[model samples]
Target: MLSIRNLHASVDGTPILRGIDLEVKAGEVHAIMGPNGSGKSTFANVLAGREQCRVTQGEVHFQGHDLLAMSPEDRARAGVFLAFQYPVEIPGVSNIYFLKAALNAIRKYHGLEELDAMDFISRVKSKVEMVKMDEALIYRAVNEGFSGGEKKRNEILQMMVLEPALAILDETDSGLDIDALKTVADGVNQLRSDDRAFIVVTHYQRLLNYILPDHVHVLSNGRIVKSGGPELALELEERGYVWLNELTAGAA
Candidate 1:
């Protein structure tokens, strides 16, 4: 669903992603693994069009369209969702209000009618149940006073509500407990289908145990140095990134 070629990016005059290439086809789940300073987060931020990360080279095509050419909101409306590593607390904005606005905005972009209050409530309830979250949190302010699990679950809630064609989850399992991780993974797992794809950027293989990506990639020094199946994760767990860096250095 997303194709990236020779993708190079920089922020604050320092390159973060260099000569990166990744392709995720529909119905596939791809995981990006890397240690600190590996540019994994930079890849996700660039994909989301965070203005600061200028694309010095390469292109990101979403389902064959120039993804970089679109504005952030347009990209989102066109079916790209990024579940942030740290969800911001939007004070004074009710979660229900925020989601309703987002849903209506996306609906209008697709030439679909906005859901009425009753329909919106009913629809959101079903998605809430999918994440096994409580409805009371919806009426509260977005991310305000929410627990770590609640914030993560809320991110999944947005994914379910938007039903994006390609979802980029950045370090989603970072702060969750085992139970919360399972719930989040189950919610993401349920979203898998023949028409959608996922790019899971994470640091651990534990999340992979539940999500089971079709492919796994290891990012380092702004490049994807290794690509393999799920077993690559086991390799990383056993040998660490030192060996991977040796391979890339030898290649260079």
Candidate 2:
């Protein structure tokens, strides 16, 4: 569903990602684990088309179309969703209203009629229940005064409601306690299907225990150093990244 060829990116004129090449097919979940400053989050920002990050080299294609050439909104309309690590608070705007506008925006992009108030309400209400979200919280403004867990839950809530084809979850498990992590993972798990794909970028292997990624990639110093199955995560957790560092240095 998504392909990256020699991808390089920079933020504020400082290079971050260096020649990243990876492919994610439909119905697959890939976990990218790396230490601090390894360009893992930069890769996610580039994929999400964040305004601050610029593509310096290489190409990114999504579903046969040029991804870097499209606007951020266009990417979202074409089934790209990023579950942010830190969700910002938008005061005075009800969460329901924000979701309606987002849902309608994508619908308009696809030449489909926008759902009326009743239809939108019914659809979102069911989705909220599926994620076990509080109905009262939906009436409140987005992320306003929500705890870390609440914010993470809200991010997954958006993912489920939008039903994007490619979901880049940038440290979705960070800051969330065990129960909250399970809640977030459950939300992501419920959305998984044969048509959707995911990239779960994180540091710890604990999150993988719940989400159970099909593939695990080790990113270090701006590139993928190794790719393996789920067991690799456990290996990393037990061994830490020290062994990976030694291996990377030996290869050089």
Candidate 3:
């Protein structure tokens, strides 16, 4: 569903992604694992069309369209979802209202009629139950006063509601305890489908234990140095990135 070729990006004139080439087909989940400063998050931001990260070279195509050419809002309406590492709190905007606006915007983009209040509420309530989220939390401001785990769950809740074609989860496991992590993973698993894909960016392998990616990639020095199967994550968990860094250096 997504194809990236020779992707390079910079933040404030400082290069972050050097050369990232990846192909994610429908029905696949790819895990991107790398150490600090390895450009994992930068890659995700670039895909999401975050303005701070500029693409200097390369091309990204999503469902036959020039993804990089589109604005961030366009990307979202076109079915690209990015679950942030840190979900920001919007104190005044209730979760339900924010999501209703977002969902309606996307529907309007596709020339569809907006959902009525009752229909919207029913749809959101079903998704909330699917994610095992609290009904009261949905009435509160987005992520406001929520714990780390709650914030992550809120992200998943959004994902479940949007039902994007491709979901890029940037460290959804961060700050989540084991139980919370499992809960988030369970929600993702339920959302998986033959026409949907996922790019899971994380540093540790613990999250993979639940998500079970179809492919595992090691990104280092702003590029993917290795690609392997599910066992690759286990190998990284056992050996860490030091060995991979040494291997990449030797190859260079």
Q: lDDT value for candidate 1?
A: 0.92
Candidate with better lDDT, 1 vs 3:
3
As a whole number from 0 to 100, the lDDT of residue 236 in candidate 2 is: 95
Which segments of model 2 are wrong by more than 4 Å?
none
Candidate 2 structure quality by residue, lDDT tens digits, 168-219: 9999898878888898888878889999999999999999989999999998
Q: After superposition, how far is residue 177 of candidate 3 from its true place, in Å?
A: 1.1
Q: Any idea what lDDT model 2 has?
A: 0.90
Clashes of each: 0, 0, 0
Model 2 residue 71 CA deviation in Å: 0.9
Candidate numbers, best TM-score first, in rank order: 3, 1, 2
Q: Give Cα distance to truth, residue 103, candidate 3, Å.
A: 0.6
Instruction: Name the runs in model 1 displaced over 4 angstroms.
Output: none
* Model 2 root-mean-square deviation: 1.3
**TM-score for each model:** 0.97, 0.96, 0.98
lDDT of 3 by residue, 162-212 (tens): 889999999999878898899889988998999999999999999999999
On a 0 to 1 TM-score scale, where does candidate 1 land against the true structure?
A: 0.97
Q: Give the total clashing residue pairs for model 3.
A: 0
